[model samples]
Target chain A: MEILVAAILTIITAATPLLFAALGELVTEKSGVLNLGVEGMMVMGAIVGFAAVHYSGSATVAIFASMLAGASMAAIFGVLVLVFHASQVPTGLALTIFGIGLSALVGQSMIGVAYDGIPQLHIPVISDIPVIGEIFFSQDGLVYLSIFMVFAVMWFMNKTRAGLILRAVGDSHDAAHAMGYSVLKIRFLAVLFGGAMAGVGGAYLSLAYSPLWVEQMTAGRGWIALALVVFASWKVRRVLLGAYLFGGISILQLHAQALGIAVPSQVMSMLPYLATILVLVIISRDRSKIKLNAPASLGKPFHASR
Target chain B: MLPRLIKRQSPSKAMVYLSPILALLLTLLASIVLFLIMGVSPSGALHAFFVEPISSIYGLTELMVKATPLILIGVALSLGFRAGVWNIGAEGQLILGGLFGGATALFFYEKTGFYIIPLILIMGALGGIIWAGIVAFLKTRFNANEILTSLMLSYVAALLLNLLIHGPLKDPDGFNFPESRLFSDSALLPILYDGTRLHLGAVIALFFVGIGWILLSRTLLGYQIKVMGDAPAAGEHAGFSHSKIIWTTLLISGGAAGLAGAIEVSGPIGQLLPNISPGYGFAAIIVAYVGRLHPLGVLFAALLLALSYLGGETAQMKLNLPVAVTGVFQGLLLFFLLACDVLIQYKIRTSKKSESTIAPAVKSSIKSTSEVK
Candidate 1:
């Protein structure tokens, strides 16, 4: 029972970052933009968050700083893809490449540096219960925030007028334009939100999860988040479930390594990635399911014509 | 008074070729600023980066040695990109090729045979084909996105490389190093230059570029690839199988990437290390885009990018700049190029009046292209 609780806790920690990133990307894609720079944004957030925490000695300051850093990175992507009419696929890749270089250069001194993990929310009386209390009441505020975002995003997408407008823009930019919607403006904001979310997800890695700075620390979680959005078929609720599923696979490998299994560590490391490929194959096998929910203008560049 | 982007009725042919040069110039300007910001003398740093790397014949040979894998991978990726197949697993395929190529070398450990080099090269390409084959199969059979599958497979490939080196191919005489035993003389690529690392692989890469150019510009297969990319429905109307194009391009690109990997290990490094690649596969994507997805353009882009690798090393040695600058430069170049591509389809104008006239013309052109299907 103790082992089970511990494993579940680790899975929550692992899944929270993906959830944040995928949710942000989900909003962006729903607005008809595909920002592949999530990995880049996440790594930048991780490094900047680590640096801000080290210097300011405040987790709140660090979180905001990381969000700003991520937003700035997304802004670069937006200007190119949205304003300049660049190809989304290559532009997103460029953003990632630039982010990686910039992050590594900036965090040169902070490599291998460690800090205290983010403080958990300690709710009085609620913390005294069994496994449920430890899992639900004791997690860091950001974990709860990640979960809260799922509900918030779901509510916003289905219940709000703005959400419908965003979806309409994604469905057909020309039709949406005829209806008086600004596709570029909507997509630009969505991209920024996605960037900020990816940044916070990255921050969770550096400030809360491992509480240290390392180059490429996000280590393909950004890419996994990208896959998660696709595997979820752009559904907010499915993004949450997919994040936990991937998180579970990741922690399972860690546990296997700790158990002194006969398998090599590298072999164990292949589990999450292989599982990603496997899950992608399974999810994509149903063409109708993907086509049903996928944003029509997901990757197409919108050229506004008066 | 506001600048409205006026759509071009047809894409500017001049911009298609000219934008890369414009991007390269912009990157230079950006790099100069970057170096100045780093507090290094811009001229000295630039010279150290661009001129010093190939000032000597020996340096020129090393340039080709470095450009070998890039050109090979770039040309293959160009083929796939043109055909609308995003095979992002070239890095993984390269690693797998090295593993199999190195395995062949180790199998003939201490035996010298004239057939060894060709055998290793063939096996290396076959390894890449098999790895990329998984991506192709999943894409065809399961309708999976090759982008995600291939990328995920890359991480799996990296882990597999570590597993192979640490356990299955660990050098016996070496003090527990996670690497394979050195290849025999016959297993190694024949040297093409004296006092340099230039080998048979460099020649092969150049040859592949020529072959790629001819195949792309003058063949029925090339026409099918172009059709498949621009209009898939037209490809179907023309009775060309969509799955066939995917498998063919993937196998070709995967095969080429594998050849480059085997060559890197056999030519320069001379043995399989725990990690043989320094992200050559990913860098080749930059090369493909910079080259405008043309085989000949890839040749030039490969040389320039290879020079950046040399420049980064020189910068670290002389200017005390971080080697990460190479990646930054490549990223910036791609960004600038993408931004410049806007000029190909649109022009900035001060009047909304011109946009009114051009917008419908551009829209009609777009419609007409689709009408070809």
Candidate 2:
């Protein structure tokens, strides 16, 4: 029972970052922009968050710093793709490349810095409960925030007037423009929000997950989060489910070794990535389903013309 | 008045060739600012980073050595990009090629067969093809996104290489190092220039440039690829097979990347290590774009990008700068390049008060040209 609780905690730690990033990307794609720089933004957040915590000794500052770092990266993407009309695919690729390099350069001095993981929530009355309390209530602040954001995003996308405008822009920017909506403004805001969320996800990794500074520590989780967005078919609830599923798969390699499984550790490490490809293939095989859910102008550049 | 973009009636033909040069100059200017912030004299750092690396004959040859793999991979990626096949997993395919070629070299370890070198090259290409073939199969068979699958496979390939080097292919004769034994003389690429590490692979890469140019500019398949990228509906209407193009482009890229990997191990590396090619696969994507996706253009772009690698090393030694600066510079170059490409399709103009009309978009016949003056 104790071991199971421990495994669940690890899974939560693994899933929170994916959840944060995918939710952000979900919102971005809904605004007619496909930003593939989540990985880049996440890594930037990780370094900045770690550095902030190292210098200031405050997790709150670290988290905010990480978000700003991510947003700044996204702002660069926003200028190039939104204003300059650069191709989305290559521009996103450049963002990832630049983010990784900038993070490495900035984090060079912060190597070997370490911090104890962040404080977990302990509600006075509920904290004493056995399995349920420990599993659900005792997660770090980010985990709770991740769950909260999932529902928040759901409500925002389905209930809000602004959300409809964002969706309208995504489905057909020309029609959105015809309706007197600033398609670019809505998208730029969505992209910034996505960047901020990705930043928080990065902060969760450096501040709470490993609680250490290492270059490239996100370790392809950003890419996995990207697949989760697809696997969810652009639905908020499904994204929550997919993040946990992928998180569980990613942690299986660790548990397999603990359980004395005979598989090579390297082979086991490949599971999450392989699972991602498998999941993508399955979800993507339903071409019409993907088409129905995917934003019609998802990767197309928008040029508002008279 | 806010600056606004006016759509060109047709893309500027001059910008097609000129944008890369503009991007390069902008990158150099950015580098000056970056260096100034780092507390180094901008001119000294720029000289150390760019000119000092190619000052000697050996340095120039090393530039070619670095550029060879880049040229090979860049040319193939350019073709794929033209065909709308984004195979970003060339790095993984390259690693697989290295593993396959290294295995063949190991198979002929201590043996001197004349055909071993050619056999190693073929196996390397086969390794890359098989790796990329999975992506092709998935995309064509299941309609999977090639970008995500290929990128995922790269991580897998790296882990696979790690596993083999640590276990089955570990150098038995040496201390338990996580690397394979050095290849025999027959398996190594033949030297082109004595007293320098220049090898036959450079010539092979140049040969592919000619081949890629001919295939892209002079073939029916090339025409089909262009149509598919520019207008898939039109290509389908014209009876071209999308699946066939995907297969052709992916295989060519994978094969080229794999061959480059094999050449690296045979030519300069001489043995398998835990890490090989040092991000050559990712950097090739930049080369393909900066070269304007033209074969002859890619050749020059490859050389310039290759100089970044050389300059990074020189700066590290001379100016006490971190090697990560190279990656930063490379990314900045790509960013600037993409930004400049906007000039190809639009003319930037200052928005005049008379040109501030926004409500006329609803009328289909309202032309913006009347407000331009």
Q: What share of the true interface contacts does each candidate keep?
A: 0.80, 0.78
Q: Residue B343's C-alpha lDDT in candidate 1? A: 94
Task: Pull out the clashing pairs in model 2.
Answer: none
- Each predicted complex: what DockQ? 0.81, 0.84
lDDT of 2 by residue, A49-83 (tens): 99998889888888899989989999999999999
lDDT per residue for candidate 2 within B1-373, as digits (tens), equals 7778988899999999999999999999999998988899999999999999999999999999999999999999998999899998999999999999999999999999889999999999999999999999999999999999999999999999999999999999869999999998999999888999999999999999999999998999889989999999999999999999999999999999999989998889998998987889999999999999988899999999999999999999998898888888899999999999999999888856435444656333456555564
Off by over 4 Å in 1: A257-260, B352-373
User: Clashing residue pairs in candidate 1, if any?
Assistant: none
**Winner by TM-score:** 2
Residue A26 accuracy (lDDT) in model 2: 94
Worst 10 residues of 1 chain A by lDDT: A252-261
**Worst-scoring 10-residue span by lDDT in model 1 chain B:** B351-360
Docking class of 2: high
